[model samples]
Target: MVLYFLALVFGLHIVMVNLGIAFSTVIPILKRKGEKENNEIYLRTSKQLMNFYAATYGLAGVFGTAFTVFLLSFYPSFIGLAGHLTFIPFGIAILAIVVHFFAITAYWYSWDKWKSDTHFLIGMILLISVYLIPLGFRAISAFLNLPQGLELTPKPHLDVVAALLNPTFLPLYLKSVTAALAAGFFTISSAYMLKYGKGDKEAIKIVEKFMPLATIAFTIAIVLGIIYAETLNLFVNYKFENAFGFLIAAKAKYDFSWLFIIKLAMFALQTIAIVSYLKIRKAWRFSKYIVAAGPASLIAIFAGEMLNSFSQYPYFVAKLADKEFVSSIPQPIRDYLAERLNLELSNPLATSMGLYTLTLVFLVPLLISAVIFLYILLFGKERSEALD
Candidate 1:
């Protein structure tokens, strides 16, 4: 239950956060070019994306914080040790988040105030920071898996440097880059499809330009993911006999190739949807295929996550150590959940509270926001007037 909830919230949050990074970087470039070319499409698209990013940014924060709280609450004991060792990475992440807030706020609000070069420079740093933010996160996650630093157990304490240098850190970070780019570009492309899916040539052109990049990034993401998994298989003690089993015969144990196959198949269809439209421009001028890419990308991402998590079952952080830590949950709660829900529980108490927070805070706002978004979509001018 905990793993599923974490996956649900964490996966959604990761997509939105990376999308914010992607569009934030693109908006300034598009703004500059739009000014030079006197292209209303570029200008309007940037503005719309800015509004979308601003709105979703708040939701991302909510989910991200919720994710952290659940982690701490569920694995209080294990994370206490892990957190002490991993605090440096978390510290770096928090500092980055602070800078990110101010940078993005300035970028978003100072559009009318700042000069072009100055604003673009800020946007560049903002992109750098956005990309840098994930490094700390993935590093910490990697440490949890490999935990080489924990083994160091320095005289004073754990070596922060060694912890950050976990074997899987670089590979996972590289893998995450693919997800960030693919998600980000897909977000931009989908937004274009939504706002101007009504036979707008400029909008279609923008979609054409961005969708291809999204497809390509997703392809690279798959390749990087394979490399990362192979690195993990080599490094981590707990092996997935089922992962890459069909392709890599030596690794085969059972019929666990199904998820891997489906994840690839979904992305393949997505690529075909994007490419087919690119080749046949006239017939697909306003094709649903363009909009269809949104769902396809999301499904692919979710499926990939499911496959990754499923391959490593029954262990929260498995590594070669004197002592191995299993799932982080009370035994009674874990047993109850297993018997009743046929699911594993990480932190039942945290899950209960987190669900409340998710419902009241995130879910309610989502409902209200959905209605408001529909109003904006259906009647932007009128809604803008009423809000004003």
Candidate 2:
């Protein structure tokens, strides 16, 4: 259950972050074009979209902080403490939440009146700063794990700050940013199809203009993702050992033919989505296909990340001490379960959260299907008209 929750949280974070970047970059560019062309509808829609993106950014930060705290609670030793610790990363999380609130306030109240140039600059700075804060915390957390074990002390000859500053960090950051941009572009493309595409030639023209931007953003994201993976391989080889090492060893034993096939399939789907957007100029038929393709690629990326995390599992902190620390069932909990119920310590993962698994398997898909059906029923005409 915890793993599933974590995956969902991380997936949402990736989507929202990318969407925020997409709106931040693409909106301004489009707004400038709208103004030059004296296109009021385009200007209005762009501003509204920008405001929505800014608001969603705050929501994402709030959820992100909650997820971070949940993760910390699950493995407190990751920060060098048995329980909560006043680490620099935690401090940054708090600061990010505060900044996100301010950004949301600025976006909400400035709807009618144009913000002063100074205020707008400040708002932009705050938004960008908040966006990067989580990345910084993640990098720090990963670095602090280099020593491994239950203690917070820095490992011999290993500096957490120095590890945080390694060459790999910059590439990772860029990769994440580009990924966010791709997500944003994909989302905006969907929105354009939903809200504007139809027999409305003007709306189709606007969407057509945006399609190339989305395609370029997605292309950059994929390229950067590949580069980032290479850097990660180097990091694992030069600085680490353990299950991750085991997994790397396993990967090395086999040619990545299957992985390459998956990558190619993802790339082809994304390319098809872009082409559909360029040619269709409508939302009715191919919008869901595009949406699914974008997220499918994202899921593949998540699967790769999961493999890395699994390599580091059981040991919350790695290579920090002479011996690795593994989590144990608390004696009290174990005793209670033993006396009052039949418990299997050897296979906890299978039985730990039966209810959650059931809910995910049955409820989530049903809900999505119902929603999609409702959308089609209500908006089918609009979609058809847009396409016509």
The TM-scores, one per candidate, come to 0.79, 0.65
**Least well predicted 10-residue stretch by lDDT in candidate 2:** 337-346
- At residue 7, candidate 2 shows an lDDT of 56
lDDT per model, in order? Answer: 0.66, 0.52
Error of 2 at 143 (Å): 2.1
Please report the TM-score between candidate 2 and the true structure.
0.65
Model 2 regions lying over 4 Å from their true place:
28-37, 54-62, 79-86, 115-119, 141-161, 237-264, 275-308, 314-388
The predictions' CA RMSDs to the true structure, in order, are: 5.8, 8.0
Q: Compared with the true structure, what per-residue lDDT tens digits does model 1 show for residues 83-171?
A: 55667788788888888878778888887588978887877767777777888888776865666565321321456688767777887
**Candidate 2's residue-wise lDDT over 104-199, tens digit each?**
566545644664454455456555755666565556545434422222234223344665665555565676666566656665565555554344
Measured with C-alpha atoms, the lDDT of residue 77 in candidate 1 is 53
Which stretches of candidate 1 lie above 4 Å from their native place?
Answer: 155-160, 194-196, 237-262, 281-284, 320-388
Displacement of residue 154 (Cα, Å) in model 1 is 3.8
Worst 10 residues of 1 by lDDT: 320-329
